[model samples]
Target: MSMLNIPLFFQDTAAVEGDMGMLWMLLSGILVFFMQAGFTLVESGMTRAKNAVNIAMKNFLDICVGSITFWLVGYSLMYGDTSNGWFFWGGFMQGEGADLFFQTMFAATAATIVSGAIAGRTKYTTYIIFSLLMTAVIYPISGGWQWQGDGWLTKLGFIDFAGSSIVHSVGGWAALVAAFMVGPRIGKYVDGKVLPIPGHNQILATLGVFILWLGWFGFNGGSQLAWGGDDATGASTVVLITNLAAAAGGLGALITTWIWYGKPNLAQSLNGALAGLVSITAGCGNMTATGALLAGLIGGVIVVFSIEFIEKKLKIDDAIGAVSVHGVCGAWGTLVIGLWGVDGDTGIGLFNGGGAAQLGSQAIGVLAYAVWAIVLSAIVLGILKATLGLRVTEEEEIKGLDISEHGSIAYPGKRQREFEE
Candidate 1:
């Protein structure tokens, strides 16, 4: 091999690796984007039959608006050099910018989770406005705290590998605020009795869960940020841990609900699986398989009680348990990293002999996100409530959001007035 050929070979090799990374991002981003379909199916299927159209509409619009908004604004805010305040130096023009493509999917996801929690009774225009703001402003600014160069939270050693607290928790907290501001669906609670308003189609919700579970491979795996050489080992290992945690979570929730309610509920089991995924997300890159399994089991159990506590005690009407599954479980996942992180760098689990420093950092990060999301979301929804209103009129709500908001019904024949709100 001549020296001239050696130089050319190395150049070609670098180009090939970069191109492969770009392909990985493109494919993974698409898979993550498909999770929108999963969200739509799950949310629409779990809610009452009459509001299915409204739920599906909100989910679809979230991705459309969120993608455009993130492309326009969110990306810069999230990864830019923070020395310039809100205006960062980085643009989406450098390198492959596969990071931009991938992050856009996540931005949309963070915004869309709110749609499920406040389903059935919100105004359509309000949703559009808030979705835009969430993707463009709220989610991005907070995301910068941990991810962007010169981020304060990053300086503090806060670790969120793939956004358990950053993405899911933020969405959850916002969903809680939106649900509270909008108030419960008509007749959700009457005379201190919590009524059960089951969804129209259970099969659809199950399928949605399956789709989301499948998409998670891309969600967590693609976060490795590379596809060259040794990157494959890390990516594959992360995927394996993700799967193990999910399976553990499913079983944990199934067993708990079965013991408590005398029957294992499928819906809860599905959510348990999701909880496990969320719980392990922050630590997946650093955790042992055993650690991930433990986290998943714990997350599954927490979600059941968390759902009940939010519903029965807090009286927040989260129809899809977004607050519990994502918010509560997200915090659990983020904290678990402090306990299971073992990349020989970031994790300092107290029980694992790393002491309280990592735990403190993790707690601080968690609290910061929780406070930011809750306060900001409450303010946004509050202003909306005071001005154009938050919830629909009782008449509209009872008639159902699909017909009232969209002037159409999801099912043409099943629009019978058999049950009254």
Candidate 2:
């Protein structure tokens, strides 16, 4: 029957459900947006106190500047019409306002991940330019490859349920390139001996992790897109698995650090939780609870070793372990789907009796994202380095970016003499 002929009750019921879905989506986006604060706190707390304000500024920029860029063009690039299965130019704001809002947060997240890795030494202006490019161009193109229904990776059956590779790894790999280009913080490596530069406040970092853990419910669960019908169950399961993975990850890291360092290390344990979160993000909608736990456990363990290797062996300075937590675990999360993924009653992973095709597809997607992120990051950062410069001067490095770049301090009247040197 036509809408005009339909009963008011029936029409109201249908409209209510639709409205509820919109509310869920927008709320989830808000939760994800709050994660910027989590990121800021984690990064600032993990670095020297003098650079805390600078760290805060970078994160603020990620959301503020990132939202505008995404609204203007990034959203269109990611979800617009396309026949070539690559990307599209659907003009400005071509989709639903709610979708654009949700995706804007993701774009900001991809850009913010880099801020933590290059925390102590990067220039503010250079970071601004990079953030704009990342939110506007780099992340959207890669994201379209999978999230967009018409994209090639989507056509190939690549499964990244909630962007382990699309969002986290893209950011993670970009972080790797940016860190390498900017080089290590002063005194991080002296004459081949690795020096430990403990964060100014572990408490803040710990709190930040808690906030991120809370925010992740929205990150993974919100990806469900609806709250009625089977969507309610699906979103709930995603939240449960995400929590299980994060808890398992924290435990895994805690245990590994105790064994390796002969003591329980809080820092590694914190990152382990995040690593587990990243590990399960790609497979959260596909894996069983057991599979998610195992994946998270392995991800937590992997992060500890990856952090050591990057800092001690590879000699790269990732101030907050972003590369290992996001990049390495992101790839692992994507691959885990091919090993334990399930589609209702059907098993799709190799260990679950499915063939190797899904595994192969996952690997290809992982490799593709890595290469694309690395190459583009290198080109962008390289140009910025040669032109506007990437790092602050040696004098500014010792004095801190807060005073040098912003002409303000996070905490006033506190003697930074100890932190400056």
Candidate 3:
């Protein structure tokens, strides 16, 4: 049932199902909002102590800045009356404010994903501008291509259950371009070799991972967008597969790293869990339990290799592995739907006799998102690079963004001497 048919207004009391969906969606949006805290903690904990305040500020402002801009422009671009084209101006839309709030959270998430990629050295002013642009223009326009009722991709039957390719991969592609434009963190690459710059707070990072895990329940679950009868049952099933896949992904990463590096690393394990979550998101509604597990396991292993490849070969400096966990794994989840999605009113995977057609559809959708997101981000960041500059000066970077950018330190007493030294 299309949300358009559901009467969400209180005056339309006949629509009990819409009311249930509204409640469920509100709960889910609240949960996803908590993910900002998770992203903040992870970004801060993973980077140097000197930049913790800067990272925190970026995450917080992503929500504050992202919400208002998306409200004013992004929602209409995504969910308004769209033309039947690849790109359409959705125009200023008026709908349920509650639904708008739910989508705004997702917009914030897409913008926030880039924060980790360009963590250490980006200018705060430049970031704020980019965040607003991304939510108001980049993300929403791309989103319109899929989610809008009259968009071309929807006509072509591209499926993204909860935005694996739509939200996560869009952010990933932008991150890839933005990180390339910003350059790596200072000392990340000296001479020819890629050096390891481990995060400062593993415990805090671990806690952040746990919080993200909890929030994903809402992320994937509420995406069902309905609540009565079969919708409720399906939502519970989605929650189950989501949890199982995450577990499997963590285990897969743990075992792979243990076998390859000779130890089970916590950071890799946490990333693996996230990898699984991203991997399963596109197929959460249509996949069987076994399929979800396999997809997640594949996602976990894929992130390990993808991270190394990006670091060593591509030489992209992603501080928190956002590119691998969200971008690479998100693509996997979307593609896997072509391989194993159930046949019904929902979707039909190739493995279930849907044929190569679905796989072809998935590929085109992923490629389209990559090209569109990367090109737009590169253009925006390139323009910014030529004018405002992307990275901080060497002296400011050495002093830390917290002091250089914000004139304050996250841990003034303990780190002041070390920073001076």
Q: Which candidate is the best by TM-score?
A: 2
- The candidates, ranked best first by lDDT, are 2, 3, 1
Root-mean-square deviation of each candidate, in angstroms?
3.2, 3.2, 4.6
Best by lDDT: 2
Query: Any idea how many clashes model 2 has?
Result: 0
After best superposition, candidate 3 residue 246: deviation in angstroms?
Answer: 1.2
lDDT of 1 by residue, 94-163 (tens): 4436777788889898998899999888999988989998998889989989877578989998988888
Better candidate number, 1 or 2, judged by TM-score: 2
lDDT of 2: 0.91
Cα-based lDDT for every prediction: 0.85, 0.91, 0.86
lDDT per residue as tens, model 2, 1-421: 8867987776878676777788888999999999999998899999989899999999999999999998777877887574322333343342266777899999999999999999879999999999999999999989989998888898888999888999999999999999999999999999989999899999999999999999999999888877654532478889999999999999999999999999999999999999999999999888888999999999999999999999999999999999999999999999999998887657889999888889999999999999999999999999999999999998998999888998888888777675576
Q: How do all models score by TM-score?
A: 0.93, 0.94, 0.92
Give the TM-score comparing model 2 with the true structure, all chains together: 0.94
Q: Give the Å shift of residue 385 in candidate 1.
A: 0.6
- Candidate 3, residues 117-159, lDDT tens digits: the string is 8988999999999999998889998888878767888888888
